[model samples]
Target chain A: MAPMRIDQLTPGTVAHIVAIDLDELGERRLREHGLDEGVEVELLHRAAFGADPLAVRVGNACVAMRRSQAAGVTVRVAQRLEAAE
Target chain B: MSEVMTAPVVALVGNPNAGKTSLFNALTGARQKVANYPGVTVERKAGTLTLPDGSRAELIDLPGAHSLEPRSPDEEVTRDVLVGAYAHERVPDAIIAVVDATNLASQLRFVLELKALGRPMVVALNMMDLAERDGFFIDYEALARELALPVIPTVAVRRRGLEAVIAAARDALNAAEISAIRSADAPAMLVEAIGDMRGHQRQARDIAAKVVSGGDANQMTRQIDRLVLHPVSGPVLLAVILFLMFQAVFAWATPFADAIEGAIGWAQGIVMTSLPAGPVRGFLTEGLLGGVGAVIVFLPQIVILFAFILVLEQSGYMTRAAFLMDRLMAGVGLSGRAFIPLLSSFACAIPGIMATRSIADPKDRLTTILIAPLMTCSARLPVYAVIIAAFIPDRTVGGLANMQGLVLFGLYAFGVVGALAAAWVLRLTVTKGAGGGFLMEMPKYQLPAIRDLAIGIWQRAWAFLRRAGTIILVSTMVLWVFASYPKAPDGVSQVDYSIAGRIGAGLEVVFAPIGFNKEISIALVPGMAAREVAVAALGTVYAIDADDEELLEVELADRLRGAWPLPTALAFLAWFVFAPQCISTFAVTRRETNGWRWPIFMFSYLFVMAYLGAGATYWISKWALGG
Candidate 1:
């Protein structure tokens, strides 16, 4: 999966969180918040104002994340196609 | 040798991830209090360690620092304390320069700078186990020779290698004519030298590297990281975890909280039966039991809440949550740096305000300090628990979620929303400018050490008890005096004419628009002192009207249901969410910001928001519920 900017993900888009490119402190922090990898995620909402942080749904919870940190997260957009298209 | 002797005072200093607090807790046990250095708002934690030879040495834990030169208030404390310039105390007899052995290539720059301070010192190469697991081999003798200081490998969390740490400290304390290491004038020199020394990193790694190995652990951590940091699953897991924590606060604490309530009622009955009608009886029943007992009943919930917080903090999951939320915070005109302080606010505002020192920008720090009190603290738990239990129906929401926990989570969510909105307004009207950028260090994932977690929880419990015993004691006595005297006319209960009742009645006029009765109005006054006192105040007022002692929550709830209405209860909860912070928060804000302007701004804005929010809640609920 190639890395996608957080803005690319939509409300129903399912993607795998690939990697967090934070420094030692950032990596430590990402791990502490339970945001490592192999987890499925969906974009729930985005801020309508300045520096819009994305509201993301992982599992059953929702969190708002910054774009800088989100940029480090690689994702593969889940493909949804009609059964007989 | 009949000579005078003195025990050495050792100060432990390190970066935030260097396990300094764990080392301090390991050395001192439970004999420590968190305080600030005089004239500086940074936390100063000190404790005494009894050496093996019957000598007692004082251990101080300074604020975490990246370098000796200060940028934030916390780093300044580290620098000031190291150089003997802080107001509260002079420099320690020796400095324990704690470094994360795993990240030594970066952390050592600070260690090198500290060594240059020429203070009697020892290098505590903490987390050596993690370093070796990462394939780093440190030769302690080589590093010790290079720095000309005693180097000891320490796994502070496990209490391993402490004997070596203590021994090294003793050796440094006893040594004579130690060479004065030259100080680095600029941070760049130390950075450059640290970079140059990277080639020798393998040789400088402490301990027999293989002895502290964790080959499988790294692989496991990597695997766990995949799911936890996943974009798809991470947020869901975080929400579930938080939901469970809130549920535990409600479901698990109820039985214990009920038991405490029963015990208080039983004790109240005994006192009422044993004493003849007089001030003594009134004092025992109303002042002592009514005020203090009411607050104490909520201890179970607080303990449970702390248990979850401590576990999360100890397991090192909190930083990841901060990282995940940074963007959200930035979106609302807050720096990601506000995450730690705001998280700490869930426990209490005092530490949260103090923690703002981690934020380098003055405006951001002030903004965080101003809004932290809005983040529903544990003290408010008693208030919320009592009110929610009384008014809200006990049922499940969304078929699977507990209604009570959802309400609790909603309250927290309200606080977060209110905080961001306040920050947004403040940024627009008060402090308008692009401020500092976000820079936070995340630590590696680790299983929470039980001993360290236990110690942290114990410290919080002890602090809570101490506050209950002292401040609550004095305030309750004063309130008792106000509520006791100026007897009512014949055929009326004295409480109707008592100062508290009169004041409550007077305040009710102002709050009546918001659906608050006299009793609730009175509760809000002392509540400004601290949130828990509001519960006690209700107990004290309601005791005068009851035929027998009832559980404070039950009696208060029943009283509100009969006298006021659902709108009033909901409005009161809304008021608490945006109320001008308790007095202690203001005191801390003043100390933290070093002025009254920010505190004044905070109070004025919160007061406005509280009134508006409460008024809106009252009207909307009244119209909606057909009140």
Candidate 2:
């Protein structure tokens, strides 16, 4: 599939960050968390009741962010290498 | 240490939850002071550590951030200190860049940025033990060589590698002069020179590849997350955790509270015999012990509550809870970030309001602050316990839940709903529209460190005790004076003739609609300082009104059972739920916001809400089951 906003990915899919389109504050904050372009990320889970804030793994840290926040970052969906296994 | 032999300053900086705070605690031990960073609201911690060479060095715990690029006020403090832009703080002579061994690729880039400031630096590979246990080995020496800084492996939880860290810090400080490290002219534009963050990111990855021998994703963490973050089970688990936390707070703290209360009573007996029957002895018993000791009894509950908070925070589950709660809170026009500060309000609104500093948007932060007091704080526990004990019968429902306990839970639920409703209203009226985006880092899961948890619990306990000693003491003495003066016109009760009594009588006209009698109105005056004082005040009123000396020893709850009508009891509980009785909350609101505007507004709004809420409860109860 083509690259899409990080919030678009469902649980268990892995992706690499492509770019962040955000206001200055949001951009600065996300960039500080090592979410710059080319960094690998994986969608971990969504919240239980209303799955708005998605917990995505960035590097070794697990970050929880709302889709409104995650909408800024575009992620290139990782190819399913696990399918080979 | 002499002023001439001034200790050098070394900063410990890292991404949040990299164990930087634990490393600081291990290194500095108990010799640390927490203060606001000059003008900013960011907490600045500095501690003294004795170096191996028998000289002391100052350790500064800089706010955690991934890069020098400032995002929030906290990060701005770190950036300013590092770049020598903050006027009040001198640039640290050396920086200890604390990095997690498991998260080298991301953490090392931060170290790279810190190095650009051109100060003597070392990498403290914190949580090395956790790394090795999870099956990885790092060539720390190679990491050091690649970055041109020393690398020390530290297990901060176990106090391992602390000596090596201190020695490394001492060496760095000795090698670099403080004056040389800091120059107003030195223009720390060196970050751009070393290359932008992207360049450093690639270099950090290459360095990580060389130094990291073998590792896998944390398997246990992944499994825990699978269970903890599941859509169905996660929210249920969170509710259970919070529910049990509240249940445990009440269940576990009773014995300790009773023991402490007995000790105070015993001490009062001992001191009573030595003093003459005069004002000095009376002051010691009533103003100091009675007033302050009322709060001290609740310390056990506060400690129990904080222990759970500290453990959850340290174990990295709090962020997951934030993610879960954000869904509901978002509908009320608050970001998930406000969940923490608001939750903390259950223990006390002061810290809850203070905790709002981490919320990035000012509008969201202010709105959260305005509604924090609506959440029932621990101070309200004594009032509720007394009322519930008096009015509600001790019957178990479903053979498991006690009726009184269920009512207490209902009050907590009411507080939550009230806070949500207040936030919604405040967002519509007092704040800008609340669509602030929240992006919080969920730290990797680890067992909460025993030492860190102990420190956290101790810090909170000390803070509570300190408040009891100062604020609670002063307010008690002032109210005692108000309750004691004018010699109580001949043959009249002391409180009846005093200023407090007169004011209470005057206020009774206003409170009558809400089912408060003259005694309850009188109690509300001191209750402004602390909520529990109202119970004691009522006890005094009844004791004097009955003219029975033995009445002083009787439980106020028993007295209330016969005195107050059922509707009055309901009204009182409703009043407490909405009333801004504690002056301390408003005082703190003033300090945190740096003005009187929010506190005054908070007080006025809460008073109106309390009166209305109580009036409705009283009338409704009377109508439903005639007064």
**Which candidate ranks first by lDDT, i.e. highest?**
2
Residues B68-141, candidate 2, lDDT per residue (tens digit)? Answer: 77655567778888877888887788899999899888778888888877788878999998799778889998
Q: Model 1 — TM-score against the truth?
A: 0.83
DockQ of 1: 0.06
Report the lDDT tens digits of candidate 1 across residue range B81-191.
666666677557678889877655446656766765666789998987776776766776777776678889899988988878887776665652253322333244434
Question: Which residue segments of model 1 deviate by more than 4 Å?
Answer: A1-85, B1-6, B176-218, B548-554
**lDDT accuracy of residue B392 in candidate 2:** 92
Scored by TM against the true chain B, the candidates give 0.91, 0.93
Instruction: Summarize candidate 2's per-residue lDDT along A2-46 as a digit string, tens digits.
Output: 989888888777789988999876776676676878888888888
